[model samples]
Target chain A: MQLALGPLLYCWPREQVLSFYEQAAGWPVEIVYLGEVVCSKRRVLSLDEWLDLAKHLESAGKQVVLSTLTLLEAGSELGALRRLCRNGHFDVEANDMAAVNILAAAGVEFIGGPTLNIYNPRTLAVLVGQGLRRWVLPFELSHPAASELINAAPASCTCEVFAWGRLPLSWSARCYTARAENRAKDQCEIICRNDPDGRLVSTREGQPFLTINGVQMQSALTQDLAPWIPEMEAAGIQVLRLSPQYSGMDEVVECFDRLRRDPGDQEVLRRLQSLAAVGVCDGYWHGEAGFANTANGLQQS
Target chain B: MQRMKLVCPAGNLPSLRAAVDGGADAVYLGFRDATNARHFAGLNFSRDSIQQGVQYAHGHGCKVFVAINTYPQPQGWTQWQRAVDEAADLGADALILADTGLLDYATRRWPDVARHLSVQASATNPEALSFYHRLFDIRRAVLPRVLSLRQVARLIEHSPVPVEVFGFGSLCVMAEGRCLLSSYVTGRSPNTYGACSPASHVRWEETDQGLESRLNEVLIDRYGPGEQAGYPTICKGRFRVGEHVYYAMEEPTSLNTLDILPELMRAGVAAIKVEGRQRSPAYVAQVTAVMRAAIDACLADPQAYKPHAAWQQALASVSEGTQTTLGAYHRPWL
Candidate 1:
């Protein structure tokens, strides 16, 4: 139905961060989730600057939502969450239950992020009671599982799916990006910016495995649902989230937008197959091993 | 004053008995299903075994907590719900749960049963911990092993429920309860399917460099000649950046908290957990007894408790890679 650009998980310089959103304003996307969702130590732009960018995105006819940190560690982190709740500029995507409480206490309506792990319909109803307007399905939910949950979704809530980009698998308090740079977590000088697409971690045999974006680790394979748009529609998916990567991001948005405009576009699907960085994987959607790819119609759905 | 509780893991009946005999105030375990987080072959309790184990623990003045922690699938919710009802009916001391929805269900369904929040919930701070109190009425919170002693103390000062911290065992580098790395590489997550670095995905190879440990055909870590190799979990593997390769996630080691008993006691941690459910009964007996003695000595004289060298020696005999550290307790950034 609609496309949502997920918040930038990787750290970028201030100019790069500003420039990226400036370009993103023109993309054919409905919702744009901004702010840092990975490590809180990465602060290339101040809170004020993020708000300014949110205002700019809103001006460009895109719905804006601010995202809080996935893992809250210290007092400073909680304080930032409070500020975001009280900012009153745009809605917030509550990544953790702590943020959910903060937003509920502040009397702010928010979108429930994927990390909240709302698996069942009753949980969705409860969150909706707490002023949750939208819910993003966690990456591990297969098509059959998501369809069951979506069928039971409350009429008041909208359901979104993580349809593209590397699946965010986990988050840690300890920064792996900092550790990889041979620096301590506290004193590490902004090392995550060194790799825009995240540091590609491979197996010993040179197979692409995972990408590390600060404390958050993601699958190396980009999840492409172009071939399953009909299935997603049947499952009542309202929005498809595309995560921000370093290169060919605009082309990614365009390819998906073209498919959205005209469903069953084989050329676009074939184009998506060739454009992904680490190739495409849809196995988790089929309830198989996450790395198992059944792209050639050889496996049963 | 009530002595702090020592909760230990028991994957099987033998370890359950060993834990109780070694002075564990309570032994926690899961049934043989996805409802439990440690669903390995030949491990965890069956429904019958849990009833027997609870009876055994209760007879010894010890408690048993059933861990029905993983999230319930759509069609699979009935199975997990049955575990909660059965664990409660079997007279378990408490139920350790992680999913918020499941916690809510258990609290409403079995109001009289004591409920503890599993570490997989990742409720690290006072604000997060308070959510369980306000909603599900969780009696205690098993904290993730990522907090520093000072942070833990601050949280204890604010928590309405009892706090439990890891005393010794395999320290998860990633945040507990939230990790999907294993599921991303394989298909099962500790939260969704009750497995991580699952045995089925593991493979060991004799490489030219040394021993290579892999998970799902992916090289997690490589050991040099004479260097001990640890099990391959993606987070604890060695990797390279700019031609400099090393242990990117963590050095091959386990957690040792015998030296930090004083700090944990001073911080008012209600329970100290030892985390190896897959370990041998001998390892459980030896580790639990050593910790029990250490806690007693610390209570008698906080400054006078000198951990015996033999305990550390015994610990090293069953360690993951023959090296251990006070993981995240002393060094929050390591």
Candidate 2:
């Protein structure tokens, strides 16, 4: 199985993003997904800048893929998607249907992003007919569902699973970060940069509930599937996608690399748990509530 | 001026009759299973009820659209396929679908049956709409409730087929078919089970401070004394972010596009959808009546169109939070 760095879902400073990629070039990850999949207003790195970074990562022996916006609202967003699809250098990860349509119309082979919602084999076959080369499984799919989908999927289409990072639970037109700051989406300042990883939203009882990253709502707990590598392999998943966090990503990459080399390493799992922003969860993989930490044998329904 | 079609929801036989009698040009419903987005207990239709609904609607010069919008799991495609075949056998006017596989199956197996893309497909742009229309030969596509008026107009100009927009009812702040927040808190979701924030997992507790609404043990909101409580959808819940506690996503409210009927007419929207199937027959009747009046008045005289105060009052009585906004149609809401 190959480790692929998923796109950065948070807003970061330009220098930090560049330096992170430069550092990531030396990591054990074979594939790197560059570009923003969250809010389109996050222009700290322009499309050209992302393409330039992709070139840098490619020279460092990393297979690069440009990820498209998850929600395309405006003509400008669709225009950006068209450019990404026609970039002609890196393969594009089609996150939304618009991206899929554009890529298919352009006769470009693309990787289906998790948000594309390919749940059944028939949807997979339709996408495969439209030149889909690889598909990242949606975060909510359980072990049995993923296994069934992989087994039924067209042989040419590869499967990737989100193995690490906070699960992106949902996306909305209303920007939660801007709303939290008491500003409308249009008139708001770029305040999401304040919380590089994303602002934590806690329940009234003060439990870590969710994270607000601009328009995207993510789980407070990072989904760690490292312990389930064998299960994923058994399910016929070829690529493990690790979403980039603001910190401790190198350690995360190394831990997954070490796990693939030595399957039953308790020390590596412990180190991975320590680096998670809000501990770890593997419940969705086990068909339980996504917030439940099934790895510790605690199954809360 | 073309009289815009008023599509309303019918959760049961009574609601189906009520919608047709209350001036609905058409009524959309789902079978009583995971095949539809409103898969609630004691709600939706059985095969007998759907056959009766089709006869009743057709008698009243109204059309019946069956919504089989949920994405089917790999092992469960047969259930959805059976639903499409049954709806077709029942002589329904159209099949409202979201899944590409279901659409493919429906179009191939029942070529003469009309197909409408459900809002759950989340096809916001003309390109996405074009793709669905080209592949499945869909007659109409329901626009997701996330587009601004101008964006809707632009899409209409480029669309390959006629479009439908949500005219009123409970608002989903997140894009439909894409949100997993419900499953994150509970085990059920709209995509997988056709229900979001399922009532089976909900608990209402009365505490010393207030009435708390919890979904799967996560406190969605706490209502103070005399505070009107809406349904505890996770998006409308209050949460603490940094030093402040507020409706971090959206406040409990409904979407009312009564005031924008003229603009929607100008945008060439073919149909206006009223969105509440998990409601009472009375709720369906009242909403369909007001929306019918509003649409007729707007189409009759676009220049002098004005939303009646009585119509607004009638809708507010049934609206959650006792208030309504234009939602994403208004630019500031975005």
Candidate 3:
């Protein structure tokens, strides 16, 4: 029944990232994940700077977790990850297995990021043995699928589900944002900064399909599982993670906060749908196409 | 240095025989169920057929690797476990696994059998390989397609186990295990269903614009009449981004590492892999034969090895794209 803010996936300006965290200090969420989880090229917030923000957020009475990059390519990125794992102040969310290995070797208890792909209990159990404290259910897991794994997971290990935001569907070595601009990954300007929430990629028929943010591809529509709040509770999900979007992030957090207090809050759901980047989808939860959303009465289009 | 092992993929018994007869040091295949990554209709081996394949490969002094790479779900957990037992019983030389839990089970029950990490695990760096090696005692690890040549060389230098890199096949622009673009459109992903852009959901429609490929009613791409269309996966398809329509992710192509075989061999890669288990026996035979020659040429004279034009032409004819690139192996590919 607790709310947590997931890592920021976009490449925002330094001032915007700082101001967002400063405002987040007063938000109702108890836990906040901060760091660059998309492209390692995003250095708007350095590890030292992220640690400074973590210290400030900790003072603001919030538990902080440092998130690692989803795709680790260069040795320099590995060096950055080594620093994150050895931060010693806050727990780290291991996004890739290299981070997991470093944290486990250091004997540091860490949160498993969604990209770790903890699909089965044995995977969770193996991670639990290797110092996994909690795990974020991967974005693709359906409601029943999540429940099965959560049930089979060790009793002490907690489960967190991505409650609201654009679903991060895939990661590639090639940067689509750069490719879309007809630029090479090297020698190209950091053009991703131009689109804060990611550039929208639509079908040839002009239907929104996905959003490209550097190497990550996300669903064009927002995924809101607030309508299934009761089901998550019934399945013993300890926390619901709300990913940080450029706009309306605080409102998304507030709506979830209100809905948790009153599961039947109809007005809150209506406002949440309006906040959808294009439309709302909870289809992955329904065991249907990830872009389909019908159970919550949210329009798929 | 020892000659690098050449691993070829086989979907059926015929493909397995083709790989072995075509000079594959090891032939990797999956059961005809969801236990492996390449779960497709009329593909993969049944228990009896795999037993026959093992006998054939073993008799030919070749190794057979059984792939149980997909993450096992709650409902199908026991099925995956049983597949591990079956592959072991069939005398598989190694088990190419991606799931940690399944690796845990296989490690505990059949500690003697060699376990190779499947590329579906997407363990890109040296530390990740170390983790898998430390935990599962995996003997070999197939590197994901996302690493550069320098990255792959650096990893091999520090890896606890021998490393395998893809030599030729249809290219995967994304990290293998982590991508879910297929599930978003078709509701079946590589991790969950062992199929990306499952053929069941694919539909080809001819419209005014030309031929269009749709997955679960979502238009993936449109092809001109003379355009040689490849497979209908989301990443390789053309889409619109800010008034532009093109292959924003990746073009349909193959990862031809023949040009860089000497570099990979010199870097101490343990094996060269040909990735196309879902393809035909002919595709397997052609790739295995060409790669066998390429690896041998590189090993014979690392300083003077040059990829022959004939080898390139032979590979291009069977490639998914008209041409091939070194893929993420080259620094500029990223």
Assess each prediction's global lDDT (C-alpha) against the native.
Answer: 0.84, 0.91, 0.90
Ten-residue stretch with the least lDDT total in model 3 chain B = B293-302
TM-score of each: 0.96, 0.98, 0.98
Q: How accurate is candidate 3 locally (lDDT)?
A: 0.90
Q: Write the per-residue lDDT of candidate 1 for residues A219-242, one digit (tens) a residue.
A: 888887777888888888989998
lDDT of 3 by residue, A1-301 (tens): 8899999989888899999999999999999999999988878877889999999999999999999988887888889999999998799999998999999889899999998888888888999999999999988888887899888887888999998989999888888888887788885578999899999999999989999989899999888899899999999899999988899988988899999999887878888888888888888888888988765544332
lDDT of 3 by residue, B239-309 (tens): 99888899878888888998888889889999998999998999989888888888888788989899888
Off by over 4 Å in 2: A297-301
Candidate 1: give the clashing pairs: B120-B177
Ranking by lDDT: 2, 3, 1
> Which regions in candidate 3 have their CA more than 4 angstroms from the true location?
A296-301
> What is the lDDT, from 0 to 100, of the residue B278 in candidate 1?
81
Q: Which residue pairs in candidate 2 have backbone atoms (N, alpha carbon, C) closer than 3 angstroms, thus clashing?
A: none
lDDT of 1 by residue, B9-50 (tens): 899999999999999999999999789888888889888999
Worst 10 residues of 3 chain A by lDDT: A292-301
Candidate closest to the true structure, highest lDDT = 2
- Angstrom error of the Cα, residue A59, model 3: value is 1.0
lDDT of 3 at B28: 93
DockQ, 0 to 1 scale, candidate 1: 0.58
